[model samples]
Target: MDFTAILGAWIAVGLTLFILSFLYRDNPLFKIAENLYIGIAIGYIFSITIYNVWIPKIYQPVSNRVFTSLSNWVPWVSKFVTPAGDAGSLTPLFPAIIGISLLTRIFPKISWISRYGFAFIVGYGAGLAIPATVATMFIAQIEGTIQPVFKLASGGAIDLSGPALWTSFSAILLCLGVIVTLFYFFFSLEHGKISKKVTKIGIYFLMVYFGAAFGTTVMGRFALLYGRFFDLYTYRTSGYYHATPILILLVLIFFFVYFGKSRKTSP
Candidate 1:
Protein backbone atom coordinates (compact mmCIF):
# COMPACT_ATOMS: atom_id res chain seq x y z
CA MET A 1 0.00 0.00 0.00
CA ASP A 2 0.99 3.60 -0.42
CA PHE A 3 2.41 5.38 2.65
CA THR A 4 -0.79 7.36 3.20
CA ALA A 5 -3.02 4.28 2.99
CA ILE A 6 -0.75 2.32 5.36
CA LEU A 7 -0.66 5.21 7.78
CA GLY A 8 -4.46 5.52 7.73
CA ALA A 9 -4.84 1.81 8.40
CA TRP A 10 -2.50 2.03 11.36
CA ILE A 11 -4.38 4.99 12.74
CA ALA A 12 -7.73 3.25 12.28
CA VAL A 13 -6.48 0.12 14.01
CA GLY A 14 -5.04 2.14 16.90
CA LEU A 15 -8.23 4.12 17.34
CA THR A 16 -10.41 1.01 17.25
CA LEU A 17 -8.24 -0.76 19.84
CA PHE A 18 -8.25 2.34 22.00
CA ILE A 19 -12.04 2.49 21.90
CA LEU A 20 -12.45 -1.23 22.55
CA SER A 21 -10.07 -1.05 25.52
CA PHE A 22 -12.97 0.49 27.44
CA LEU A 23 -14.54 -3.00 27.60
CA TYR A 24 -11.80 -3.80 30.12
CA ARG A 25 -11.71 -0.41 31.84
CA ASP A 26 -11.83 3.29 31.04
CA ASN A 27 -8.23 4.46 30.80
CA PRO A 28 -6.15 7.08 29.08
CA LEU A 29 -6.40 5.15 25.81
CA PHE A 30 -10.17 5.14 25.92
CA LYS A 31 -10.29 8.78 26.96
CA ILE A 32 -8.02 9.76 24.09
CA ALA A 33 -10.17 7.82 21.62
CA GLU A 34 -13.37 9.29 23.09
CA ASN A 35 -12.05 12.83 22.83
CA LEU A 36 -10.77 12.25 19.33
CA TYR A 37 -14.14 10.83 18.25
CA ILE A 38 -15.96 13.81 19.71
CA GLY A 39 -13.61 16.28 18.08
CA ILE A 40 -13.92 14.59 14.70
CA ALA A 41 -17.71 14.38 15.01
CA ILE A 42 -18.00 18.07 15.86
CA GLY A 43 -15.74 19.09 12.99
CA TYR A 44 -17.64 16.83 10.57
CA ILE A 45 -20.98 18.23 11.69
CA PHE A 46 -19.82 21.83 11.45
CA SER A 47 -18.42 21.31 7.95
CA ILE A 48 -21.62 19.58 6.79
CA THR A 49 -23.79 22.34 8.28
CA ILE A 50 -21.76 24.98 6.48
CA TYR A 51 -21.61 23.21 3.15
CA ASN A 52 -25.11 21.75 3.08
CA VAL A 53 -27.18 24.35 4.93
CA TRP A 54 -25.31 27.65 4.92
CA ILE A 55 -23.39 27.86 1.66
CA PRO A 56 -25.90 27.02 -1.05
CA LYS A 57 -29.01 28.24 0.70
CA ILE A 58 -27.62 31.28 2.55
CA TYR A 59 -24.49 32.36 0.70
CA GLN A 60 -24.64 31.52 -3.01
CA PRO A 61 -28.20 32.65 -3.61
CA VAL A 62 -27.56 35.90 -1.76
CA SER A 63 -24.20 36.57 -3.38
CA ASN A 64 -25.20 36.11 -7.00
CA ARG A 65 -28.90 36.49 -7.73
CA VAL A 66 -28.50 36.59 -11.48
CA PHE A 67 -31.02 34.56 -13.46
CA THR A 68 -30.06 31.13 -14.83
CA SER A 69 -28.37 30.95 -18.21
CA LEU A 70 -28.14 27.28 -19.17
CA SER A 71 -25.81 27.84 -22.15
CA ASN A 72 -23.26 29.58 -19.96
CA TRP A 73 -19.99 27.80 -18.94
CA VAL A 74 -21.63 27.11 -15.57
CA PRO A 75 -23.96 24.16 -15.16
CA TRP A 76 -27.52 24.53 -16.48
CA VAL A 77 -28.85 24.06 -12.92
CA SER A 78 -27.98 27.67 -12.12
CA LYS A 79 -30.71 28.99 -14.47
CA PHE A 80 -33.59 27.36 -12.61
CA VAL A 81 -32.25 27.69 -9.05
CA THR A 82 -30.45 31.06 -8.90
CA PRO A 83 -32.60 33.82 -7.40
CA ALA A 84 -34.33 36.16 -9.82
CA GLY A 85 -33.26 39.53 -8.42
CA ASP A 86 -31.87 41.56 -5.48
CA ALA A 87 -34.63 40.09 -3.29
CA GLY A 88 -32.56 36.89 -3.19
CA SER A 89 -29.68 38.79 -1.61
CA LEU A 90 -32.04 40.51 0.84
CA THR A 91 -33.67 37.21 1.75
CA PRO A 92 -30.58 35.86 3.50
CA LEU A 93 -29.78 39.00 5.49
CA PHE A 94 -32.22 38.38 8.34
CA PRO A 95 -31.05 34.85 9.14
CA ALA A 96 -27.41 35.82 8.55
CA ILE A 97 -27.81 38.67 11.01
CA ILE A 98 -29.33 36.34 13.56
CA GLY A 99 -26.59 33.78 13.04
CA ILE A 100 -23.88 36.43 13.47
CA SER A 101 -25.66 37.71 16.56
CA LEU A 102 -25.30 34.22 18.02
CA LEU A 103 -21.48 34.60 17.90
CA THR A 104 -21.78 37.60 20.28
CA ARG A 105 -21.94 35.11 23.14
CA ILE A 106 -18.13 34.93 22.96
CA PHE A 107 -18.03 38.51 24.32
CA PRO A 108 -19.60 38.75 27.77
CA LYS A 109 -20.73 42.36 27.33
CA ILE A 110 -22.62 41.66 24.09
CA SER A 111 -23.73 38.15 25.04
CA TRP A 112 -27.28 39.45 25.41
CA ILE A 113 -27.46 39.68 21.60
CA SER A 114 -27.24 35.90 21.47
CA ARG A 115 -30.60 35.65 23.19
CA TYR A 116 -32.32 37.10 20.15
CA GLY A 117 -30.78 34.41 17.98
CA PHE A 118 -31.68 31.72 20.49
CA ALA A 119 -35.25 32.96 20.70
CA PHE A 120 -35.56 33.10 16.94
CA ILE A 121 -34.19 29.57 16.63
CA VAL A 122 -36.47 28.24 19.35
CA GLY A 123 -39.57 29.94 17.95
CA TYR A 124 -38.85 28.80 14.40
CA GLY A 125 -38.06 25.26 15.56
CA ALA A 126 -41.27 25.03 17.58
CA GLY A 127 -43.32 26.39 14.73
CA LEU A 128 -41.81 23.82 12.39
CA ALA A 129 -41.92 20.91 14.85
CA ILE A 130 -45.50 21.20 16.09
CA PRO A 131 -47.18 20.32 12.80
CA ALA A 132 -44.53 17.71 11.91
CA THR A 133 -44.74 16.08 15.33
CA VAL A 134 -48.51 16.02 15.29
CA ALA A 135 -48.68 14.52 11.84
CA THR A 136 -45.91 11.96 12.36
CA MET A 137 -46.45 10.97 16.00
CA PHE A 138 -50.20 11.29 16.36
CA ILE A 139 -52.07 11.24 13.08
CA ALA A 140 -49.80 8.80 11.29
CA GLN A 141 -49.73 6.46 14.27
CA ILE A 142 -53.54 6.43 14.45
CA GLU A 143 -53.72 5.84 10.71
CA GLY A 144 -51.29 2.91 11.02
CA THR A 145 -53.33 1.43 13.84
CA ILE A 146 -56.48 1.52 11.70
CA GLN A 147 -54.82 0.50 8.44
CA PRO A 148 -56.59 -2.23 6.37
CA VAL A 149 -54.96 -5.64 6.53
CA PHE A 150 -56.25 -7.85 3.71
CA LYS A 151 -54.31 -9.18 0.72
CA LEU A 152 -55.28 -9.36 -2.92
CA ALA A 153 -55.84 -12.79 -4.44
CA SER A 154 -54.77 -14.04 -7.89
CA GLY A 155 -57.97 -12.63 -9.36
CA GLY A 156 -57.41 -9.26 -7.74
CA ALA A 157 -60.03 -10.08 -5.12
CA ILE A 158 -59.57 -9.50 -1.38
CA ASP A 159 -58.14 -12.73 0.04
CA LEU A 160 -60.20 -13.12 3.20
CA SER A 161 -59.90 -16.90 3.06
CA GLY A 162 -56.42 -17.55 4.58
CA PRO A 163 -53.70 -14.96 5.25
CA ALA A 164 -56.21 -12.20 5.93
CA LEU A 165 -57.20 -13.93 9.14
CA TRP A 166 -53.64 -13.69 10.53
CA THR A 167 -53.33 -10.13 9.24
CA SER A 168 -56.59 -9.11 10.86
CA PHE A 169 -55.60 -10.76 14.12
CA SER A 170 -52.28 -8.90 14.22
CA ALA A 171 -54.05 -5.63 13.40
CA ILE A 172 -56.54 -6.24 16.21
CA LEU A 173 -53.67 -6.87 18.63
CA LEU A 174 -51.94 -3.61 17.60
CA CYS A 175 -55.14 -1.62 18.01
CA LEU A 176 -55.80 -3.16 21.43
CA GLY A 177 -52.22 -2.48 22.52
CA VAL A 178 -52.50 1.17 21.48
CA ILE A 179 -55.79 1.53 23.32
CA VAL A 180 -54.54 -0.13 26.49
CA THR A 181 -51.28 1.86 26.45
CA LEU A 182 -53.20 5.10 26.04
CA PHE A 183 -55.51 4.17 28.90
CA TYR A 184 -52.49 3.33 31.03
CA PHE A 185 -51.20 6.87 30.47
CA PHE A 186 -54.59 8.45 31.18
CA PHE A 187 -54.32 9.67 34.77
CA SER A 188 -57.95 10.73 35.06
CA LEU A 189 -59.15 7.14 35.36
CA GLU A 190 -58.47 5.84 38.85
CA HIS A 191 -56.50 2.58 38.95
CA GLY A 192 -59.36 0.42 40.17
CA LYS A 193 -59.36 -3.41 40.05
CA ILE A 194 -60.20 -3.77 36.36
CA SER A 195 -58.07 -0.78 35.40
CA LYS A 196 -55.11 -2.27 37.23
CA LYS A 197 -55.38 -5.51 35.28
CA VAL A 198 -55.67 -3.59 31.99
CA THR A 199 -52.71 -1.41 32.86
CA LYS A 200 -50.69 -4.54 33.65
CA ILE A 201 -51.31 -5.73 30.12
CA GLY A 202 -50.17 -2.33 28.86
CA ILE A 203 -47.01 -2.66 30.89
CA TYR A 204 -46.38 -6.10 29.40
CA PHE A 205 -46.65 -4.67 25.91
CA LEU A 206 -44.28 -1.85 26.83
CA MET A 207 -41.79 -4.30 28.27
CA VAL A 208 -41.85 -6.37 25.10
CA TYR A 209 -41.27 -3.17 23.10
CA PHE A 210 -38.38 -2.14 25.31
CA GLY A 211 -36.83 -5.59 25.12
CA ALA A 212 -37.13 -5.70 21.34
CA ALA A 213 -35.58 -2.23 21.06
CA PHE A 214 -32.69 -3.20 23.32
CA GLY A 215 -32.09 -6.42 21.41
CA THR A 216 -32.09 -4.52 18.13
CA THR A 217 -29.56 -2.05 19.52
CA VAL A 218 -27.30 -4.88 20.70
CA MET A 219 -27.56 -6.55 17.30
CA GLY A 220 -26.73 -3.26 15.59
CA ARG A 221 -23.59 -2.89 17.70
CA PHE A 222 -22.62 -6.45 16.91
CA ALA A 223 -23.10 -5.65 13.24
CA LEU A 224 -20.60 -2.83 13.61
CA LEU A 225 -18.15 -5.21 15.26
CA TYR A 226 -18.72 -7.63 12.42
CA GLY A 227 -17.98 -4.86 9.95
CA ARG A 228 -14.66 -4.08 11.61
CA PHE A 229 -13.60 -7.72 11.55
CA PHE A 230 -14.78 -8.11 7.98
CA ASP A 231 -12.60 -5.17 7.02
CA LEU A 232 -9.65 -6.63 8.87
CA TYR A 233 -9.96 -10.00 7.17
CA THR A 234 -10.94 -8.74 3.72
CA TYR A 235 -8.16 -6.19 3.45
CA ARG A 236 -5.57 -8.40 5.14
CA THR A 237 -5.89 -10.92 2.32
CA SER A 238 -5.51 -8.14 -0.25
CA GLY A 239 -1.67 -8.28 0.15
CA TYR A 240 -1.42 -4.49 0.35
CA TYR A 241 -3.41 -4.44 3.60
CA HIS A 242 -1.92 -4.96 7.08
CA ALA A 243 -4.90 -4.07 9.25
CA THR A 244 -5.03 -7.38 11.13
CA PRO A 245 -1.39 -7.26 12.30
CA ILE A 246 -1.65 -3.57 13.08
CA LEU A 247 -4.83 -4.25 15.06
CA ILE A 248 -3.09 -6.93 17.11
CA LEU A 249 -0.12 -4.66 17.73
CA LEU A 250 -2.40 -1.84 18.86
CA VAL A 251 -4.28 -4.22 21.13
CA LEU A 252 -1.02 -5.19 22.84
CA ILE A 253 0.14 -1.59 23.08
CA PHE A 254 -3.16 -0.36 24.53
CA PHE A 255 -3.36 -3.15 27.11
CA PHE A 256 0.21 -2.49 28.26
CA VAL A 257 -0.35 1.25 28.48
CA TYR A 258 -3.66 0.80 30.26
CA PHE A 259 -2.16 -1.57 32.83
CA GLY A 260 0.84 0.68 33.42
CA LYS A 261 -1.41 3.70 33.88
CA SER A 262 -3.69 1.80 36.25
CA ARG A 263 -0.75 0.69 38.40
CA LYS A 264 0.67 4.18 38.51
CA THR A 265 -2.63 5.79 39.52
CA SER A 266 -3.60 3.03 41.98
CA PRO A 267 -3.95 4.09 45.61
Candidate 2:
Protein backbone atom coordinates (compact mmCIF):
# COMPACT_ATOMS: atom_id res chain seq x y z
CA MET A 1 0.00 0.00 0.00
CA ASP A 2 1.03 3.63 -0.60
CA PHE A 3 2.15 5.71 2.40
CA THR A 4 -0.66 8.31 2.18
CA ALA A 5 -3.56 5.80 2.16
CA ILE A 6 -1.90 3.84 5.00
CA LEU A 7 -1.46 7.03 7.03
CA GLY A 8 -5.07 8.17 6.40
CA ALA A 9 -6.55 4.78 7.29
CA TRP A 10 -4.43 4.61 10.45
CA ILE A 11 -5.61 8.06 11.53
CA ALA A 12 -9.27 7.17 10.88
CA VAL A 13 -9.10 3.85 12.76
CA GLY A 14 -7.19 5.40 15.65
CA LEU A 15 -9.79 8.12 15.96
CA THR A 16 -12.58 5.53 15.82
CA LEU A 17 -10.99 3.55 18.64
CA PHE A 18 -10.48 6.72 20.63
CA ILE A 19 -14.22 7.45 20.38
CA LEU A 20 -15.09 3.85 21.23
CA SER A 21 -12.91 4.11 24.36
CA PHE A 22 -15.75 6.12 25.93
CA LEU A 23 -17.74 2.85 26.12
CA TYR A 24 -15.18 1.75 28.73
CA ARG A 25 -14.84 5.18 30.38
CA ASP A 26 -14.77 8.86 29.45
CA ASN A 27 -11.09 9.79 29.42
CA PRO A 28 -8.84 12.42 27.83
CA LEU A 29 -8.66 10.17 24.76
CA PHE A 30 -12.44 10.32 24.38
CA LYS A 31 -12.45 14.11 24.91
CA ILE A 32 -9.84 14.53 22.17
CA ALA A 33 -11.89 12.34 19.85
CA GLU A 34 -15.12 14.21 20.64
CA ASN A 35 -13.55 17.63 20.09
CA LEU A 36 -11.92 16.55 16.83
CA TYR A 37 -15.27 15.21 15.60
CA ILE A 38 -17.00 18.53 16.39
CA GLY A 39 -14.20 20.57 14.77
CA ILE A 40 -14.34 18.42 11.62
CA ALA A 41 -18.13 18.80 11.43
CA ILE A 42 -17.91 22.62 11.75
CA GLY A 43 -15.12 22.75 9.13
CA TYR A 44 -17.19 20.56 6.79
CA ILE A 45 -20.23 22.86 7.18
CA PHE A 46 -18.08 25.95 6.44
CA SER A 47 -16.69 24.30 3.29
CA ILE A 48 -20.21 23.43 2.13
CA THR A 49 -21.52 26.95 2.81
CA ILE A 50 -18.60 28.55 0.97
CA TYR A 51 -18.40 26.23 -2.04
CA ASN A 52 -21.89 24.86 -2.53
CA VAL A 53 -24.12 27.61 -1.10
CA TRP A 54 -22.37 30.99 -1.24
CA ILE A 55 -20.42 30.50 -4.45
CA PRO A 56 -23.32 29.12 -6.48
CA LYS A 57 -26.27 31.05 -5.07
CA ILE A 58 -24.70 34.37 -3.96
CA TYR A 59 -21.29 35.08 -5.54
CA GLN A 60 -21.84 33.66 -9.02
CA PRO A 61 -25.21 35.34 -9.57
CA VAL A 62 -24.01 38.76 -8.29
CA SER A 63 -20.73 38.48 -10.23
CA ASN A 64 -22.44 37.29 -13.43
CA ARG A 65 -25.66 39.34 -13.42
CA VAL A 66 -25.13 42.35 -11.11
CA PHE A 67 -21.50 43.08 -12.00
CA THR A 68 -21.98 42.28 -15.68
CA SER A 69 -24.89 44.73 -15.88
CA LEU A 70 -22.65 47.43 -14.38
CA SER A 71 -19.72 46.50 -16.65
CA ASN A 72 -21.90 46.68 -19.83
CA TRP A 73 -22.32 50.48 -19.27
CA VAL A 74 -18.52 50.78 -19.59
CA PRO A 75 -17.42 51.73 -23.14
CA TRP A 76 -15.07 48.82 -24.09
CA VAL A 77 -16.79 46.08 -22.01
CA SER A 78 -20.25 46.79 -23.54
CA LYS A 79 -18.95 45.64 -26.95
CA PHE A 80 -17.07 42.59 -25.55
CA VAL A 81 -19.74 40.89 -23.37
CA THR A 82 -23.45 40.08 -23.12
CA PRO A 83 -25.36 40.85 -19.91
CA ALA A 84 -27.03 37.92 -18.12
CA GLY A 85 -30.79 37.57 -18.69
CA ASP A 86 -32.72 39.82 -16.33
CA ALA A 87 -33.71 37.85 -13.22
CA GLY A 88 -36.28 40.63 -12.51
CA SER A 89 -35.28 41.15 -8.85
CA LEU A 90 -32.28 41.61 -6.54
CA THR A 91 -33.90 39.63 -3.63
CA PRO A 92 -30.79 37.39 -3.42
CA LEU A 93 -28.64 40.27 -2.20
CA PHE A 94 -30.95 40.90 0.79
CA PRO A 95 -30.62 37.28 1.99
CA ALA A 96 -26.85 37.30 1.39
CA ILE A 97 -26.56 40.50 3.43
CA ILE A 98 -28.70 39.09 6.22
CA GLY A 99 -26.53 35.95 6.38
CA ILE A 100 -23.39 38.08 6.57
CA SER A 101 -24.99 40.35 9.17
CA LEU A 102 -25.60 37.31 11.40
CA LEU A 103 -21.81 37.24 11.98
CA THR A 104 -22.08 40.58 13.81
CA ARG A 105 -23.53 38.64 16.75
CA ILE A 106 -20.00 37.30 17.38
CA PHE A 107 -18.86 40.82 18.37
CA PRO A 108 -20.02 42.39 21.64
CA LYS A 109 -20.77 45.98 20.60
CA ILE A 110 -22.14 45.36 17.07
CA SER A 111 -24.26 42.37 18.20
CA TRP A 112 -27.41 44.51 17.95
CA ILE A 113 -27.03 44.49 14.14
CA SER A 114 -27.59 40.69 14.19
CA ARG A 115 -31.13 41.17 15.54
CA TYR A 116 -32.31 42.50 12.15
CA GLY A 117 -30.88 39.37 10.54
CA PHE A 118 -32.63 37.19 13.15
CA ALA A 119 -35.93 39.04 12.74
CA PHE A 120 -35.82 38.74 8.94
CA ILE A 121 -34.92 35.04 9.13
CA VAL A 122 -37.59 34.26 11.73
CA GLY A 123 -40.31 36.22 9.88
CA TYR A 124 -39.38 34.76 6.51
CA GLY A 125 -39.09 31.22 7.89
CA ALA A 126 -42.49 31.51 9.60
CA GLY A 127 -44.04 32.83 6.39
CA LEU A 128 -42.79 29.73 4.56
CA ALA A 129 -43.49 27.34 7.47
CA ILE A 130 -47.03 28.21 8.61
CA PRO A 131 -48.86 27.20 5.45
CA ALA A 132 -46.93 23.90 5.12
CA THR A 133 -47.41 23.16 8.84
CA VAL A 134 -51.14 23.88 8.63
CA ALA A 135 -51.60 21.76 5.52
CA THR A 136 -49.62 18.73 6.75
CA MET A 137 -49.92 18.69 10.55
CA PHE A 138 -53.29 20.33 11.16
CA ILE A 139 -55.57 19.84 8.17
CA ALA A 140 -54.15 16.58 6.85
CA GLN A 141 -54.02 15.03 10.34
CA ILE A 142 -57.63 15.97 11.05
CA GLU A 143 -58.63 14.66 7.63
CA GLY A 144 -56.85 11.36 8.30
CA THR A 145 -58.51 11.03 11.73
CA ILE A 146 -62.06 11.64 10.40
CA GLN A 147 -61.90 10.03 6.95
CA PRO A 148 -62.80 6.38 7.63
CA VAL A 149 -61.45 3.45 5.65
CA PHE A 150 -64.42 1.41 6.93
CA LYS A 151 -67.30 3.84 6.23
CA LEU A 152 -69.09 4.49 2.94
CA ALA A 153 -70.32 8.08 2.54
CA SER A 154 -72.72 7.23 -0.34
CA GLY A 155 -74.60 4.54 1.59
CA GLY A 156 -74.41 6.41 4.94
CA ALA A 157 -73.45 3.12 6.60
CA ILE A 158 -70.27 1.54 7.93
CA ASP A 159 -68.68 -0.71 5.26
CA LEU A 160 -67.54 -3.71 7.29
CA SER A 161 -65.98 -5.43 4.28
CA GLY A 162 -62.20 -5.92 3.86
CA PRO A 163 -59.46 -8.57 4.23
CA ALA A 164 -60.47 -10.57 7.34
CA LEU A 165 -62.49 -7.47 8.33
CA TRP A 166 -59.31 -6.07 10.02
CA THR A 167 -59.93 -2.66 8.36
CA SER A 168 -63.11 -2.20 10.37
CA PHE A 169 -61.42 -3.51 13.52
CA SER A 170 -58.50 -1.10 13.11
CA ALA A 171 -60.83 1.86 12.41
CA ILE A 172 -62.89 1.13 15.54
CA LEU A 173 -59.76 0.84 17.71
CA LEU A 174 -58.32 4.08 16.25
CA CYS A 175 -61.52 6.05 16.99
CA LEU A 176 -61.65 4.65 20.54
CA GLY A 177 -57.95 5.44 21.18
CA VAL A 178 -58.38 9.02 19.91
CA ILE A 179 -61.44 9.59 22.11
CA VAL A 180 -59.85 8.05 25.21
CA THR A 181 -56.58 9.96 24.72
CA LEU A 182 -58.51 13.24 24.36
CA PHE A 183 -60.33 12.47 27.59
CA TYR A 184 -56.95 11.85 29.30
CA PHE A 185 -56.02 15.50 28.72
CA PHE A 186 -59.48 16.89 29.63
CA PHE A 187 -58.87 18.51 33.06
CA SER A 188 -62.23 20.39 33.03
CA LEU A 189 -63.96 17.31 34.46
CA GLU A 190 -62.59 15.83 37.66
CA HIS A 191 -61.03 12.43 36.88
CA GLY A 192 -63.10 10.10 39.04
CA LYS A 193 -62.61 6.28 38.96
CA ILE A 194 -64.23 5.97 35.51
CA SER A 195 -62.13 8.84 34.07
CA LYS A 196 -58.99 7.31 35.64
CA LYS A 197 -59.82 3.97 33.95
CA VAL A 198 -60.15 5.67 30.56
CA THR A 199 -56.85 7.56 31.11
CA LYS A 200 -55.12 4.26 31.93
CA ILE A 201 -56.12 2.99 28.46
CA GLY A 202 -54.57 6.14 26.96
CA ILE A 203 -51.39 5.53 28.94
CA TYR A 204 -51.14 1.97 27.54
CA PHE A 205 -51.52 3.26 23.97
CA LEU A 206 -48.88 5.94 24.58
CA MET A 207 -46.45 3.38 25.97
CA VAL A 208 -46.94 1.13 22.95
CA TYR A 209 -46.48 4.06 20.55
CA PHE A 210 -43.30 5.23 22.36
CA GLY A 211 -41.95 1.68 22.47
CA ALA A 212 -42.35 1.32 18.70
CA ALA A 213 -40.56 4.62 18.13
CA PHE A 214 -37.69 3.60 20.41
CA GLY A 215 -37.43 0.21 18.70
CA THR A 216 -37.28 1.88 15.29
CA THR A 217 -34.45 4.17 16.45
CA VAL A 218 -32.50 1.21 17.85
CA MET A 219 -33.03 -0.69 14.58
CA GLY A 220 -31.70 2.25 12.57
CA ARG A 221 -28.53 2.53 14.68
CA PHE A 222 -27.99 -1.23 14.50
CA ALA A 223 -28.44 -1.17 10.70
CA LEU A 224 -25.74 1.52 10.38
CA LEU A 225 -23.40 -0.40 12.74
CA TYR A 226 -23.95 -3.55 10.70
CA GLY A 227 -23.09 -1.75 7.49
CA ARG A 228 -19.84 -0.37 8.95
CA PHE A 229 -18.90 -3.77 10.39
CA PHE A 230 -19.67 -5.39 7.04
CA ASP A 231 -17.25 -3.05 5.28
CA LEU A 232 -14.59 -3.67 7.94
CA TYR A 233 -15.05 -7.42 7.58
CA THR A 234 -14.79 -7.29 3.78
CA TYR A 235 -11.63 -5.16 3.98
CA ARG A 236 -9.99 -7.46 6.55
CA THR A 237 -8.97 -10.00 3.85
CA SER A 238 -7.05 -7.24 1.98
CA GLY A 239 -3.57 -6.31 3.22
CA TYR A 240 -3.76 -2.48 2.81
CA TYR A 241 -6.67 -2.11 5.27
CA HIS A 242 -5.39 -4.23 8.17
CA ALA A 243 -1.80 -3.72 9.37
CA THR A 244 -1.71 0.08 9.69
CA PRO A 245 -4.97 0.39 11.65
CA ILE A 246 -3.90 -2.46 13.96
CA LEU A 247 -0.50 -0.94 14.55
CA ILE A 248 -1.96 2.52 15.20
CA LEU A 249 -4.61 1.09 17.56
CA LEU A 250 -1.96 -0.79 19.57
CA VAL A 251 0.22 2.33 19.82
CA LEU A 252 -2.71 4.45 20.99
CA ILE A 253 -3.77 1.86 23.58
CA PHE A 254 -0.21 1.65 24.98
CA PHE A 255 0.18 5.43 25.01
CA PHE A 256 -3.11 5.96 26.84
CA VAL A 257 -2.36 3.16 29.32
CA TYR A 258 1.20 4.29 30.08
CA PHE A 259 1.14 8.07 29.79
CA GLY A 260 -2.41 9.48 29.68
CA LYS A 261 -4.23 10.86 32.75
CA SER A 262 -7.28 8.90 33.92
CA ARG A 263 -9.51 8.55 36.96
CA LYS A 264 -10.07 4.82 36.38
CA THR A 265 -7.30 2.24 36.55
CA SER A 266 -7.29 -0.88 34.31
CA PRO A 267 -7.19 -4.47 35.68
Per-candidate TM vs. native? Answer: 0.75, 0.78
Off by more than 4 A, model 1 = 50-88, 106-108, 147-160, 257-267
64 Cα displacement, candidate 1 (Å): 5.3
Assess each prediction's global lDDT (C-alpha) against the native. Answer: 0.80, 0.74
Model 2 quality (TM-score):
0.78
lDDT of 1: 0.80
Write the residue-wise lDDT of candidate 2 on 158-262 in tens digits: 555665268667767887888888888889979999889999999888888899999999999999878755544543445555844565468567657755544
How well is each residue in 82-149 modelled by candidate 1, as lDDT tens digits? Answer: 55444345477789999999999999999999999999999999999999999999999899999676
Candidate that scores best on TM-score: 2
- Measured by TM-score, how close is model 1 to the native structure? 0.75
Determine which window of 10 residues in candidate 1 has minimal summed lDDT: 64-73
Residue 178 miss distance in model 2 (angstroms): 1.8
